[model samples]
Target: MRFIKRLIIGFVMVIILGICLYCYARLIEPNMLLKKSYSVTVPKDVKELKIVFFTDTHFGKYYPQEKITRLVDFINEQKPDVVIFGGDLIDSYNRDQELVNIEELSKSLKKIKASYGKIAVYGNHDYGGGAEPIYEKVMTDGGFKILRDSELTLSDLNLSIIGYDDYLLGSVDPNRYQLPDAPFRIVVTHEPDVIDNIKANGSLLVLAGHSHGGQVTIPFMKGVLRPGAEKYIKGQYDLKETITGCDATMIVSEGIGMTLKPFRFLNPPNIVVVSLKHK
Candidate 1:
């Protein structure tokens, strides 16, 4: 009789715990924001640069547009020289288009100040749900240069930034586009796995987002992998041999928003601050 009683109590306790976890994941955790920082070494002659990178902010029903104010505030506090947005500005342009305020969104984005310039690339979500035109217009209105399968050279900083189209929805033919000759190069993309197809002779730094760190990570297990983010999910990876047998360092952000799932457990929204220093 005692054994049965104890079993019943244990079952009830488990049920209670589950309910608590569900509430936390849904209400408390998703709103939490985190800041992740990384440092990279550049050539001696290259000027040091501070770059703030963020992505995967599915700003729609799940992620409210008002949160952009907080995002811009957090980014400005970092005092970045260059700001790079990885994409997915809105969650679903088709379903949530009417809900978003383009004018206010553009105003908040414009407030984010970057000394050198602001750069952005398309994401899978950006091209999905007829979001291509809206995404481009918003970023451009916010003073961002949208780079699609092209490279932008900052002669003053002697730095080159290569932006690619979304691998899942947009064109990403590395063979068709020529790489810049700048001594320092930074590549930005929505999906990290695209690194496998890019062929560069020298070392490069790649920044990406879209994994959302599984959106709900469990202990001792890997985060849920997305179609385009199978190999590289989150954090930093050093690849000795890429497409052209060149070395590259990649940092994948967890991102600052949610998508299909509205809850965030262990993985919260985040922005990455990269400090590039002279070697």
Candidate 2:
């Protein structure tokens, strides 16, 4: 009887510890590198456009410069015509005092060349990083164009990338980009759940983060629970044809780094680089 009791207690302790570890990895000290290959068909005139998007980097207090520099280097090697960084660029707990060197990371990212130019949006972590002021400085000074509930068009690529503000805080403007009667319209956002209501309306593709793919998913099943995960979370899925009948693809990234946790299980950090190929 005594031995059985001890075994039960040990099992319970392990379970508790596992949960704690997952929480940290998912929310606290998670360091991840995620890479995926996606090819989509656009008009032959599209000329194989590639875009590298970095999301939820949460660089603050713990994560450092060398790590981000390596990521930036990899992005350059991809040679994307345009680069998009989904926000949370800085992570801080002081609520007032900023942590990490975002300027350096921004400078590194600025080195990534794209004919169309780089763009980005805000995440919940961006809110923690002093929202507008700090985030604006990091990107604009670091050579990135921060889009606060606005739209920017790339005439050369014949593509339009729409940027939406932070999803967590609510009250973001969704402005329409005057797309040049093209076959594809791309939109960039920090969170995935928001797209649930967005259907495929006038857009060919939607890119988002904030799910972190549960930061650690087990085998043979979906994530135990994804943060802010709507019906579609992690990986690529269809948003369904709207009553208006729009054809848009939704790609949700597992993203890099952890906001509240610091551990990753089956899920690793990653960057989504997809080519607009001839399908």
Candidate 3:
């Protein structure tokens, strides 16, 4: 009986510790982002441009509109030449039109800025109850170009930015996009698993954000659950020569929202600032 009591006490202590750490990381980490820099080794001669990529802002019961606004403030301060959102921007699911989660986000997210351009795709959570229309509208009103398995070229730099439709939605053919003979090209998607969805010529770099870094990662065990991605489910990873031998840098941001339980343990919301220094 004494042993069982001890075990229960130990478990409660651990939970307390975990919550405390998450709060510290989120509230005090000045920069909640786990920043990464990558060099697009391909296409050799383009001027370097910095990009701030982030994803998965499941702003609902767990995270709110005010929380996302805080994140937007941090990201804009980075002054990225280009900004990209990987996916899962909202999480209301449309079951209730009266929920203020998605609606508030739609109103508050128009404050972000990107010099070259801002682009994004939608995630599974962003498909229901008119989430897409509202999300796309908010982004467009904010001056961002919403890419739906489409590409746009920033004439000033000639870089083509493409957005691949979420694989969970339907089929995506990477071949549809003809990478222009430009200096740089990039692709944004919600889940990193879409690395296989690149049936067409892939971009120089791909950004994603569906795995919340396991949300509540443990000391020696994996997160209680996985949002997406099976292997190397940490925060960031580099997928070199794949089964197809195509080489493009792949980055998976840990993301800035919580899901299921709405409490993050070791995983803090990220606001990544990626500086592209191609050599």
Candidate No. with top lDDT: 1
Question: Which portions of model 3 show Cα errors greater than 4 Å?
Answer: 1-44, 93-107, 170-184, 199-203, 224-228, 243-245
**In lDDT terms, how accurate is model 2?**
0.70
Error of 1 at 107 (Å): 0.8
How much is 31 displaced in model 2, in angstroms?
A: 4.8
Model 2 over residues 1-279: C-alpha lDDT tens digits?
999999999999999998987676666445546478777667665557888887877666545556877787778788888788887766663542445655566677677777778887888777764555667777887678877777777777667677877767745754433233446677787877766555344437778888777766667767656445655568887654531355667788877776554566666788899888766
Q: What is the lDDT of residue 174 in candidate 1?
A: 58
> Would you give me the overall lDDT of model 1?
0.87
Which tens-of-lDDT digit does each residue in 1-279 have in candidate 3? 999999999999999997877776555432354555554554545557788887887766556656666777778888889888877766665643454554455556667778777787777766754576677776666566778788877777656777877767635665754444433467787777766545334336778777777777768877754434655354545555552444566777778776566566677777677666655
Ranking by lDDT: 1, 2, 3
TM-score against truth, every candidate: 0.95, 0.80, 0.79
lDDT minimum window of 10 residues, candidate 2: 173-182
- What is the lDDT, from 0 to 100, of the residue 57 in candidate 1? 88
Against the reference, the lDDT scores of all candidates come to: 0.87, 0.70, 0.67
All-Cα superposition RMSD per candidate: 1.5, 4.1, 4.1
